[model samples]
Target: MTSASELLALRSELTGSLVLPGDDAYEAARTPWNLSVDQRPAAIAEPADIADLQAILRTATAAGLGVTVQPNGHGANGDLSGVVLIRPKRFDLLAVDEQARVLRAGAGVNWGRALERLDGTGLVALAGSNPEVNVVALAIAGGQSMFSRRYGITARSIISVEFVDAAGTVHRVSDADDAELMWALRGGGGLFGIVTEIELALYPGDAIFGGGLMFPAEVAEAVVTAAFELARDEPELGLDVGMMHFPDAPQAPPHLRGRTVATVALVHVGDEATGRAFADRIVAVAEPISDTLTSFTIGSLAAVAAEPVEPMPSADFGVALDGLDDAFAREFVDAFTRGAARGLTRCGIRAMGGAIADELGAEFAAVGATQADALMSCSVLLFDPTIDVDAAFAPMRDLAARYPGGATLPTFLSSGATLADAYDRDVLDRLAAVKQRVDPGGVIRSNRPLG
Candidate 1:
């Protein structure tokens, strides 16, 4: 264990800040974005520059302490203990090469900041719905993109990576320079090294259209089935549907409490007319309680999810599935509703196909569910610490078992999931070998570690 004195000394090595155990600020410093997770890390270090990073690594190696990097702790699992939790928020760097059609972001840079610059550039990155998510985190975990059907997964858009190895060595890598590490970084999670920066290829797009609709519980089945029917074979359109049930409690939203609502959000990487026509068809199913579809640029796409920015206790459960026929859609919606009645606050499904399922030959990165037709997920807030997350997710797991697509992505894995859950046996073995070679002493740890 790194003692209080050694951790205290680490403060002088960093330009940013370090909070050790027993300090008044330790609890808040050690806390992650997912309030459900309880991570009692030994120390929380925020290094401002590359020099500070080297100093941290040197000190950590001497003390036999492993270091894990979390820009904002969006992917915090529950098992962090006795490690130095490094937050790279001070490493803020954002640059776009318009001529080259590439975006370079530092570890601290989030999609919101990047999108702000790309708003009028006629270029779009492989960004996800939540603009608060760090760009590097999304790229490393192969996060599902708002334009994934057009641009593929975020990992495939990676052009290069700048990272610091476990031995305090800094390296800038790409497919041509370090093919193995580059492939691993593409979608192998953050297990090999502490990534400092990344560059993503940008796509041509001056405008993107999206809209949100919220329907009452009465037409939930009809709305769910309509989404699947309209979304099939449409490569440029992305549809994300959700069934949210709010309980009569303080944790629920004030305006939405004691209600079950079916929400639909669509993003189309095309012109205004086609997108509006599609929205009109969705409105014809049943008059929605609310409609907010309109033509806009990629910058305004963040509003579709309208996700909460503040930290909260949340449990995420996800599964990849084969196509759900109309009958199965009804059955699944019924099952999902019943599961939500049990405890799940929201059950979400994203139409996955087009570029997402296209295999990039044999030398491609290790991304999960490359051929999946759809991705289903469930989430529940664990405000009551006594609630068991696994138990709350059991029904969804049972349902997933019946329609298993045989794989799930790392970004969608449950908080307690391991690499095995997102990878095949052969792929996982290759990952293990890479880990053993790159981090022999295991100085670099991840939220989702090799174990």
Candidate 2:
């Protein structure tokens, strides 16, 4: 354990604030976005700039302590004990190069702020469904966005990364500077170092025809079948489908409370007329109870899923499927409904093909190079203390076992799986070599540690 005097000495060298275990701000500083994860680090440091970050890393290394980086604490896995929790919330930097069609964002910049900054610029950054997620973290984890079908994974769009390795050496890594480190940083889950900033290529076009179509619970099987067929027929169309179970709670809206519904969300890059025609094809297969498809700007894409903005306790179960056949679709629908009956609140599968498979080269990045047609995930809200978490996840596990395909994406991976489960042997070996070279002491700890 680090002594109080030693911590004070280290704090004196930093321009940022450091909170000890007994400090009033310690709890909030160390808390993760997922309320279920209980992380107890020895200290929490919020770096104001790159200098402060480097000092923190050097001090932690001298003290023989591990370092865990959490920009917004979205992917916390509860393994932060006995480490120095570094939150770069003060590193507020955002720059757009319209001429080059690129965006340079700091670790603290969220998708919401980035989208707002580029509102009417006729340009869009590759971002995920939840606008509140940190842009740097998502890019590092191989972000799957609304435009993934046309543009490929967000990691592939990275132009450069500015990070500080475990030895306190800062590096501006790119394909030109260091190809191996850059590839590892993309979708490798922060195993090498702390990423302070990232530059990503942006896409043109400001608008997309996107929204969701909700159907009654009774017709969930039909909805799933239709959604799979649409994705198979038009791989270029950005699509996702889900079966949500709203619990009977006062916190939920009156209309959604105690209801089960299936929804097919669409995001078409083509013109409004073509998007409408695609919607018509889906509706013709099975009429929807509620349809909100319309022409919208890229900034409004986050509203399609309407995921929760506030932090809450939740557990996730996910799987990658080779293809969604008729038999698999029926089994999936039945499993989802059964899990819903057993307290599974949200379950969905996002289509993964087109640019995701075609553009993701085997050696390009650590993720997104999958042969799977779609990725399915089931999540259970843990608001009720009496709920059985294991029982709620059983159906999802069984469903995934039925159609296991290639490795799972790092972004959707949950705890308990080894690195081999998420990557092939060769990729794992390469990642290990990078980890050994950059972080030999294994001071940089992440959810999926290659070291």
Give the per-residue lDDT digits (tens) of candidate 2, residues 1-451.
Answer: 4545667787888889899888899888888888888888878898888888788888888787888888788888765766888888887799888889999998888888887777677787778878789998888877788788777888888889999888888889898988898888777877889889899998876667878898888888877888888899888788888889888998788888999988899888768998998888778877787888888776676776576789888887777876688787788778878887778888888898888888436476777466788888778898888778778878778877777777767777775444566788888898899999999898898865652
What count of clashes does model 1 give? 0
lDDT of 1: 0.81
Cα RMSD (angstroms) for every candidate in the order listed? 1.8, 1.7
| Poorly placed runs, candidate 2 (over 4 Å) | 1-4, 359-362, 416-418
What lDDT does the true structure give each of the candidates?
0.81, 0.81
For model 1, how does the per-residue alpha-carbon lDDT over 1-451 read when each residue is reduced to its tens digit? 4466676787876788888878899888888888878888878888888877887877777787888987888889855666788898887899999999999999999888888888888898989778788899989987888688877888888889998888879989888887887778878878887889999999988877887899998898888888877778576578888788888898777878888989898888888898888877777888898788887887776776576778888888888887567875777777767777667788888878888877763255777337776888889887656666666677777777777876777888877887687878877887888888888888888877655
Backbone collisions counted per model? 0, 0
Q: Any runs in candidate 1 off by more than 4 Å, and if so which? A: 250-255, 384-391
Residue 206 local lDDT, model 2: 65
